[model samples]
Target: MKEEQKHIEALHDIKDMMNRSSRFISLSGLSGISAGLCALAATIYIWPVWLAVREKLRTGGDLQVYPYPATDVQRLLIMTGIVTFLTALLLALLFTWMRSRKTNTSMWGSTAKRLMTNTAIPLIAGGLVTYRLLDLELVGLIAPSCLIFYGLALLNGSKYTVSEIRWLGICEIILGIINLWFIGYGLVAWAIGFGVLHILYGALMWWKYERV
Candidate 1:
């Protein structure tokens, strides 16, 4: 019986090792937290610009937020979005890389490539669709589409990583769907979906996985 138990334990250890090598499990919850903070800060910074544009248009009796914004304002908004994305991307990569190092895992391996490929497909599709929407001036749909596609990407990639990500993705998709009816509050929805949800997910993950 003692020898049988030892053999079983050894087999279990080997199974765990194989599982670790095949999956990218070094993701840190701090990465999500940092990304959320960056998103929230960007949203806070952009809120005033959006409000100022709305107020300016209101004075001219054009209170609708969907109308194409002034050229400078439009450019500013686009720049802000790009900067926010880059910042979040940078923070995520930094934290993830740190975690990988701490775990003595390769950050750029076959598993990572698979994860990225699964994630990028929906995002790329969403980006192309959003660009066309912007061209057609259907800007209201942009936020919802982004949320939905991001949720889908997360869902697609979650199979390769932690299961918690799938729940986050579901929440995001639900929020995006609801936002469709509330187009007037697109920015608010975006903030909640990207900023608030990320923070919550990060906190939960940290508490569950990182805390003693």
Candidate 2:
């Protein structure tokens, strides 16, 4: 009886260790779906405005009100930064809520902290660089570069998350390469890459992991 109890305790300890080392536990499929939906909505909301500005630029009309031409590139970058930060916050909240219901582990634990820092730092840096290049009117390649670097960040951090996420990262990189041929359609490309891709990925995750 004593030996049997020891074996049971040892088995429980091994299970606990395995749980701690696994990367996919804190990830919530519903959160992915929600984020994707939000991106799609945001893209739909922003598209008309983007089209109007582009039409004006094509017609050689004044762009004073658009803010992109007159505002320093850094200001535009700040806007991008704000958008990125808000998106991250929203996703973080979703992750936290899902993890709370799905597991005993805290979403804000060391693992999550490491994941965010690793994924975000490269993205932010690449975004700033892209903004600077855009400001210089050296813009034909900016969107693709941004996508590629963002995908790199995702791929690099995939070990701390689901394998599906790494596949998505690979897709993003491929899409970014294809986007190079559509330089004049940068806004549309951005919408498809960030907005559409997220929706698809999120839906898949939700269906596969969260539907139960």
- For candidate 2, the TM-score is 0.75
Task: Give the per-residue lDDT of model 1 (tens digit) for 2-37.
Answer: 999999999999987886877777778888898888
- Measured by TM-score, the strongest candidate is 1
State the RMSD for candidate 1: 2.4
Q: Model 2, range 29-145, lDDT digits (tens) per residue?
A: 656556666656665765675566567565764333222443553355446546754885588577756665677777777767777888888788888887777676655567687
Count of backbone collisions within predicted model 2: 0
- TM-score between model 1 and native: 0.90
Q: Which candidate gets the maximum lDDT versus the true structure? A: 1
Tell me the whole-model lDDT of each prediction, alpha carbons only. 0.85, 0.69
* Residue 197, model 2: Cα distance from true site in angstroms: 1.5
